[model samples]
Target: MAADPVVSVDAVSKVFATRAGPVHALRDVSFSVPRGHTLGLVGESGSGKSTIARLVLGLERPTTGAVRFESVDLSAAGRAARKRMRRRMQMVFQDPYSSLLPHLTVLSNVVEPLRLHGIGTVAQRRERATQMLVRVGIGAASAGFYPRQFSGGQQQRIAIARALVLEPEFLVCDEPTSSLDVSVQAQILGLLQGLQRDLGLTCLFVSHNLAVIERMATEVVVMCGGRVVESASTEELFAHPAHPYTRRLLAAVLPLEGDAPPLPADDWDPASLDDDEREVVRISPGHYLRA
Candidate 1:
C-alpha cells in the first residue's frame, strides 16, 4: 500500500446496523480501476477489502458513496439494470473449492452464468464454456467431473474459467491464490496475468499479500480499518511508500531465500531531504526505512 500523495485530510466513515448495534466497516475509501487496469486492494483481515469487492460487483451498495461500473451507478441502479450490468463483470472468490458449485459438473458450472443471463442457445453456451475451460487449461474430457475430483489448483482454474465464460470486461479476483501451495500459487498467478493480458481485463484484485499485488496490479489502493490509507501506481507505491502503515507493510515482507534488502550507499545525509520525509531513512533513491 502506498500513502496518500497529494494532501492530508480528516476521515469520514461507514457503518452497518445490526441487533448488536452499528459496526464500522469502511472509512472514506476512494479509488478507481481504469479501463484494462488492475486495482489491487490489500489489507489485513476485517480491513474491508472483500466489502469493496461486493460493492463493486453490485452485490452490496455503499452506504455513503457510489460504486460505478462503466459509468453506470450500480448503487443507484434498478435490479433489472444491475442484472444486465452483471454480465459485463465477474468475480473469482478466495476459495475455489467453495466458490464453485460442488454438485455441478465443471462444464455445467461454467455454463450456469450463460444460462442465467440467457446468453445464447444451449449448444452455443456449451461451446463457449468448453472454449473457456480449454483456455484455462481444463480439458473437455474433465468437464463432466464434479469439483471434488480436481485438486485445489485445478478447481481454481475451473473457477477462473467460469468467471471468464461471460467474456467479462471487468474481473474482480478476491484473494484468488491465497489457499494454494507456493508452486501452485505461481501457476495460478501466471494464468491470471496471461488471461488479463489476452482479454484486456479491467481488474480489482484483492489480497493481503503485497507480493501478489505487486505482480498483478497496475495501481493499488491500501486499506486499513476500512479506510484507504494510500493509493498509487504499483511502481510508485512499492518504491516510495509514504504512510507509516504502508512502510510497516513493506517491512513485514519476508524476503525470498538468499535475497535481502540492499543497504544504503551512505554517501547521502538526512539533512539533504525534505523535512516531512526525514522521518524515514533513505535506503536508496526510491526506497525508505522508518526511523
Candidate 2:
C-alpha cells in the first residue's frame, strides 16, 4: 500500500468576512503531500493557492473543513500539541527580504528559530546555524552581516537556513523565487531540490510559473477561482489537461506546446470565475498575496 500522506487537506473551505462581504477563498479544496514528494499549486493571482498554503501551515484556520498534519487534525489538536507540530513544519514565504528580520544578522536569524524552540544550547545553535548557512552557500564569515548587506539570493538562502535549522519534515514554500532575479531563481531552486533530496522532505510548493512547477513537483493541483480544476501527476497533467481552465493556463505559459489546445474566445472570461454555476468567490481581505 502507498505510505500515508505527510500532510492532508480534507475537503477544506475557507471564508473570510471582509468589509465588502464574505469572500470564499477556498471551496472544498483538498489534496495530500506524500512523504518526500512535492505538491505544486498553480494558478493565476487569485486562485486560492496562497490561501491553501496558510491553511496547511496552520497560520490560518479553514472556515469550514479540516487540515491534518501527519493525520493529526489541526483544528482539534490541543495547544501544546499544536505547538509541537509547529516545530515539525515550516514555511518559506515569497519575499525573503520582508520575512527575515532586518535588524538581525544572518547567523542570528537562523539561530532565532532554534532559540525560540529551545532546540539546543547557545553554542550548539550557533554551530547548527553555521552548518546550515554553509550548506546553502553562505560562509560563516558572512553570518554577521545584516539582511541589507547580502544580495537578494543570499537573503533567501539565509531565510531558508532559518527554516531548515529546525530540521522540519514538512515545508511549505509559497512562490519562494517569485521575487528573485531570473538567473538567481534557478540557483535557489536547485538548492531547494538538493536539500529536499538529502532531507526526504514533503513539500507544498505554490507558484504561478508553470515551468517551475513542472520542474519541482511530482504532482500538480490546478486551481481556478477557489476550486481545484485538475489534480494529477506532473507528467499526465502536462501531457493531458482535462479541465478547460487548466488548458488555458498551460496555453498562456507554454504557448508553443502542442498539448495545450487552442482556445476559443468565449470559452473563458478573465473577469469572472464562473463555470456555469456563476459563483463569485473573492479572495480574503488583507491577503496581499491573494491566493
Candidate 3:
C-alpha cells in the first residue's frame, strides 16, 4: 500500500576484473531514494560512491544484487525498457567543462537529451531548453555561447540546465559543485535546492563534504571501503555518530579559526574492530551504524 521508491539499490556489489585481480568496488550496498527527497552519499576517494552512481544509472551492471528505478529492476530490463527508464532519470557530473560538448552551443547542449529522446518538436525543445537555462540563472542571450566561453560556475549551471531540461523525476548529482569556487558552489547549491523544492525531485547527492551534505541532504549515507558505514537522517547522524569511521570522518571536517584539529587516527582504528562491529547495527529508528 506504500508508494515505491524512485530509486533503490538492494544488496548491490560491484567487482571490477583487472590485470592483477578483482577489485571489489562495492560490497552489499543497500539504500533507497524516495520521491521528493535528497539522499546524500558521502565518502572519500575510492569509497565506491561513484560506483553506486553508475549502478543506479545502469551504466554498470552489478556483479551481485539489483538496482531498481520506479519499481523496475534496471539490471533485468530490456533495451527499450532501459531506455524508457533512463528518460525519467538524469545525472550531473563533477566536471562541467568535460560534460558539455565543446563544439555545441549552450542551448544545444541543454536540449541534446530532448532531441535524443524525441521528446518534443524542434521549436518546443528550444523553448523548453531556454526556459530551463533561465531557471538556472543563465539568460537567453548567452545560450548561444560555447561551453569554453563561460566560467567554471556558469559551465556547471549549463550542465545543471541540461540535466534538468528532461524534467527527470530522479537526479544523481555526483559532486556537481565540487569544482567551483566557494561562492559559486553556494550559488549552485542554492539553485539545486530551489529546483528540487519546486520540482519535487528525488536526488542522490554524492559528495565528500559533510558540511555540504548537511546543507542539501534529507538523509545521509556515509560510505567507507566500498561499504556503507553509517546511514541516518542528517540531524541524527551529525548529532550522534556511532561508528568509529564516521566519527573520524566528522573529526576531519576543517574547522574555523582557532578550532582544534581532528583527533589523530590512532584513536579509532578499523583494524581493531570486531566482526559484529563491522556489521550494520540499528541504533534507533531510521538509523544504522557499522559499530
Candidate 4:
C-alpha cells in the first residue's frame, strides 16, 4: 500500500482585510507532503510561501477550504487538538540570530520545547537536549554558551536542534539557510538532509533560491500571486520547466562560472503571455508548466 500523506492542503485560500479591499494572500493552494519526503515551495517575496507555512502551523486560519493532517482538518480542530498536532510539526525560521534567545544557554534553548510540552523530567530533558546538540554537530561542551558565542552556522544548527528536540515528524523550514555564507549554507543543508534521512522526517522547504531548492527538494512547487503555478519532481522541474515563471526562476540562478548576467526582471511577468501561452504545460509525468 502507498504510504499515507503526512500533511494535506486542500484548495486553501487566505485573504487579508485591507483598507482598500480584501487582499488575497493565497488562492486555491493545494498539495500533499508524503511521509519522509521533502517538498520545496519556491517563489519571490510576497508570493505566499511563508503564508502557507503559517497556515499549516495554526498561526493563521485559511479564509477558504481546509488544511488536514492525516485526515484531521487543522482549520477545524480545537485548541487542545491543535496543540497536540504541533508536537508532530515544528518550524525552523530564516534568521538564526532572532530565533535564539540571547540570555539562554544552548542547553536551555534546546530544552525549552520539552518544557513547554511538559515532556520528561528536568534531568531527562537536559540529557536529551545535550544529545540533540551533539547530534546536530554542536559539542556538549558548548551547551553552556550563549547564542552570541557561536558563528552564524553554529547558531543555525542550535536552532535545528531546538526544533528537533520534540522529535517532530514534519518540519517547515522557512529559508533556513538564506542568511548564511555559501559554504555554511551547504553544511546546514547537508546536515538537514542527513537528519531527515535518519529520522524519517517530512519537510516543507520554503525559499526563493531555486539553486538551493534544487539541492534540497524531492518535489518543487512554484508559486506566484499566492497560487501554485507549477509542480513537479525536482529533476523534471529543472530539466523541463513548463511554466514561464519556473523558466524565469531557473534562468535567474547564476551559472557555476559566476559570469552570467543577472536575469532581467521582465522575465517573471505572466501578463506578457497570451491566454494560450499562460496555461501550465505538462512536459512529462509529474512535471507541469505555466506560461
Candidate 5:
C-alpha cells in the first residue's frame, strides 16, 4: 500500500469576501502529498495557487472543507496544537528580501525559527543555523551581514536557511526562485532538490513557470481559474495533457515543431461551468483531468 500522506487537502473550498463580491478562490480542491515527495502546483496569476498555499499552511482557513497536516485538521486544531503543527511545516516565499528581517543579521534571522520553537540551546541553535547557511552556500563569515548587504540570490539562500533550520518535515515554497536571475534560479532549484533529498522532505512547490515545475515536481497539479484542470505524474502530464486548459498552458510554455498550437479564444468562465457536475474525471489509475 502507498504510504499515508503527510499533508492532505480534502474537498477544500475557500471563498473570500471582497467589497466587490464573494470571490471563490478554491472549489472543492483535494489532493494528498505523500511523504518525501514534491507536489508541484502550476497556474497563472490569479489562479488561486497562493490561496491553496495559505490554506495548507493554516494561515488561512478554508470557507468549506479541511486542510490537514499529519492527519490533524487545521481548522479544528486548538491554538497550541496549531502552533506545534506550524513548526513541522515551514514556508519559503518568492521575495526573500521582504520575507527576511531587514534589521537582523542573516545569522539571527536563520536562528529565529529555532528560537521561536525552543528547539535548542542558544549555542546549539547558532551552530545549527550556521550549518544550514553553509548548506545553502552562504558561509558563516557572511552570516553577520544584513539582508541589504547580500545579493538577491544570497538573500534567498538565507531565507532557505531560515526555513530549513528547524528541520521541517514539510515545506511550502511559493515561487521561491521567481525573483532571482535565470542563473540563480537554477542554483536555487538545485539547492532545494538537494536539500529535499538529503532531508527526505515533502514539499508543495507553487509556481507559474511550467519549466520550473517540470524540473522540481514528482507529481503535478495544473490549476486554472480556482479549479484543478489536470493532475498526473510529471512525465505523463507533459507527454499527454488531458484538459483543454492544461494543454493551452503547456503550449504556452513548451515549444512545438512547426507552428504554435491554437488555443480556444474563450477565457475560463466560471459562470458557464456547472458546479454540481463532476468537474474532474479520472483518466487513469493515478491521472485525473477536468471533465
Candidate 6:
C-alpha cells in the first residue's frame, strides 16, 4: 500500500479583494506530499505557486477548503496549535542576503528557532546549532561570525542550517537557490539532497527553473492562474508534457543548452490560441495537461 501523505491539501482556494474586484489567487488547488518525498511546484510569476507555499505555512488563509498536516487540519487550528505545528514544518526563503539578520552571529541565527520552541537549555541549543552548521558544510568555527562575514553561498548554508536546526520533518524551499550563482546553486542543491537523505525529510520545492526542479523533485506539479495545470513525475513530465501551456513553457526554455536557437517572435503570441488550448487539462495517469 502507498504510504500516508504527510500533508493533504483539499479543494483549497484563495481570493484577494482588490480595488477592481476580487483577484482569485488559487482555485480548487489540491495535492498531497507523501512522507520523505520532495514535490516541486513550478510556475511562472503570478501563477499562484508562492501563494500555495504561503498558505501552507499559514501566512494566509484560503477562501475555501482545508490544509491538513498528518490528518490534523492546520487551516482550522488555533494560534497556539499552529505555532506548535510549525516546529515540524520550516521554510528556507529565496534571498539569503535578506533572510539572515545582519547583526546576529551565525550561531545565534541557527539557535533562534530552538530558543523560540524552548527545545533545550542554552548549552544544549548551542551544541545542536554547532552540529547543524557542520552538517550543512559550515564549520563550527564560523559560527561566531556575522552574516556579513560570509559569502552568498555560505550565508545560504547558514540559512539552511537554521531551518534544519529544529530537525523539521518538512521543509518549504521557496526558490532557495534562485538568487545564487550557478556554482553556488549546485552546491546548495547538493547540500539539501544530502540533508534530506540523512534526515528522511519531505520537501516542497518551489521554483521557476525547470532544470533545477528536474534534478531535485521526485514528482512535479505545474501551476497556472492559481491552479495545478499539470502533475507528474519529473521524468514523465519532461519526456511527454501533455498541457499546451506546459509545452509553451518548455519551448520557452528549449534547446536547454548554450547552442540552441531561440523561438521566432511570431510564435510567441498568446492571443492566437483557442480557449481550450490555453487552458490546463488533465491527461494521462499522474499527469495533467493545460490546454
lDDT of 6 at 158: 95
Score candidate 2 by TM-score against the native.
Answer: 0.90
Which regions of candidate 6 deviate over 4 angstroms? 1-3, 254-282
Question: TM-score ranking from best to worst?
Answer: 3, 5, 4, 6, 2, 1
**What do the candidate models score in CA lDDT, each in turn?**
0.79, 0.84, 0.89, 0.88, 0.88, 0.85
Candidate 5 has a TM-score of 0.93
Candidate 2 stretches with Cα past 4 Å from truth are 254-266, 270-291
lDDT of 6 by residue, 8-84 (tens): 77889899999999888887888888888899999888888999998888788889998888888887899999998
lDDT of 4: 0.88
lDDT tens readout by residue for model 1, 162-281: 999988888889999999998999999999999999998878899998888989998777776676666777898887777666666676677678856622322333222223222324
What lDDT tens digits, residue by residue, belong to model 2 across residues 226-266? Answer: 87766778887777666667767776764444655444423
What tens-digit string does per-residue lDDT give for candidate 5 at 1-291? 026899999998889999999988888898888999999999989888999999999999999999999889999999999999999899999999999999999999999999998988999999999999999999999889899999999999999999989888999999999999989999999999999999999999999988899899989998877888789999898877777667667767744367455444335454444363566788887799877
Off by over 4 Å in 4: 1-3, 257-283
Model 3's alpha-carbon lDDT is 0.89
Candidate 1: residue pairs that collide: none
Instruction: Provide the global lDDT of candidate 1 against the true structure.
Output: 0.79
**Top TM-score prediction, candidate number:** 3
lDDT at residue 172 of model 6 (Cα atoms) = 97
Q: lDDT at 236 for candidate 5? A: 91
Local lDDT at 159 for model 1? 96
- TM for candidate 6 is 0.91
- Tell how far residue 57 is off in model 4, in angstroms: 1.4
Q: Which is the better candidate, 3 or 6, if ranked by TM-score?
A: 3
Q: At residue 222, what lDDT does model 6 achieve?
A: 86
State candidate 1's TM-score. 0.85
